[model samples]
Target: MTIAAYTLAAVLNVFILFIGVRFLLQPFAAAAGYGVPATQDRAYLEIKGVRDTTFGVVGLVLLIFAGAQAEAWYMLAVALAPIGDTFIVLRHGGSKAVAFGVHLATAAVVLISSALLFLA
Candidate 1:
């Protein structure tokens, strides 16, 4: 259980880092995958990139140095981002499928990861 929790946490962080990089390098594509289309203003996309990258780094740092309890708390807090994203997509004229399937699903996984870390 411990190993599984740590591994999942690490993998999730790495995946988040990848997503951040993708958002930075390919804003339009990333926004499309995020269940939204990017407008001419790319600043918000860059902000999202930075936010996700920072989150990924924080999660990794907590897991590697701060241990499971800290990582658990971080995960619990960070889960709110995706939960909010679920609504953002919905309110932004994005599809319910993407809003629920992607954002909500991610929130669920993050919460589960937090629970596992807490147990560990």
Candidate 2:
């Protein structure tokens, strides 16, 4: 359980870091994969990239320096991003499948990681 908890948290953090880099380097494609197409304005996309990148680094820092309890709390709080994203996708006329399957599912997984970290 301990190993699983740490591993999941680490993997999620790294994956989000990768996603953030993708958003920074390929905003259009990243937005498309995020269940929303990008417009000509790149500001919002860049903001999202920075936000996600910060979150990923924060999560990793919490896990490494602050330990599982801190990481758990961080995970619990960060889950809101995906929950908001679920609505963002839905409201933006993105596919319902992507809205629920991607965003909502991510929220669920993050919540589960929080629970596991708490237990650990």
Q: Which candidate comes out best when scored by TM-score?
A: 2
Q: Model 2 residue 50 lDDT?
A: 92
Q: What is the alpha-carbon lDDT of model 2 when measured against the actual structure?
A: 0.94
- Alpha-carbon RMSD to native, per candidate: 0.7, 0.6
Candidate 1 lDDT over residue span 98-117, tens digit each: 99999999899999999999
**Prediction 1 global C-alpha lDDT:** 0.92
Pick out the ten consecutive residues of candidate 1 with the lowest summed lDDT.
Answer: 38-47
Task: List candidate 1 segments past 4 Å from native.
Answer: none
Model 1 deviation from the true structure expressed as Cα RMSD, one decimal place: 0.7
Question: By lDDT, who's the top model here?
Answer: 2
lDDT of 2 by residue, 4-106 (tens): 9999999989888888988899999999999989777788898899999999999999999999999999999999999999999999999999999999999
Q: Once superposed on the true structure, which residue ranges of model 2 sit more than 4 Å away at CA?
A: none
Q: Each candidate's TM vs. the true structure?
A: 0.97, 0.98
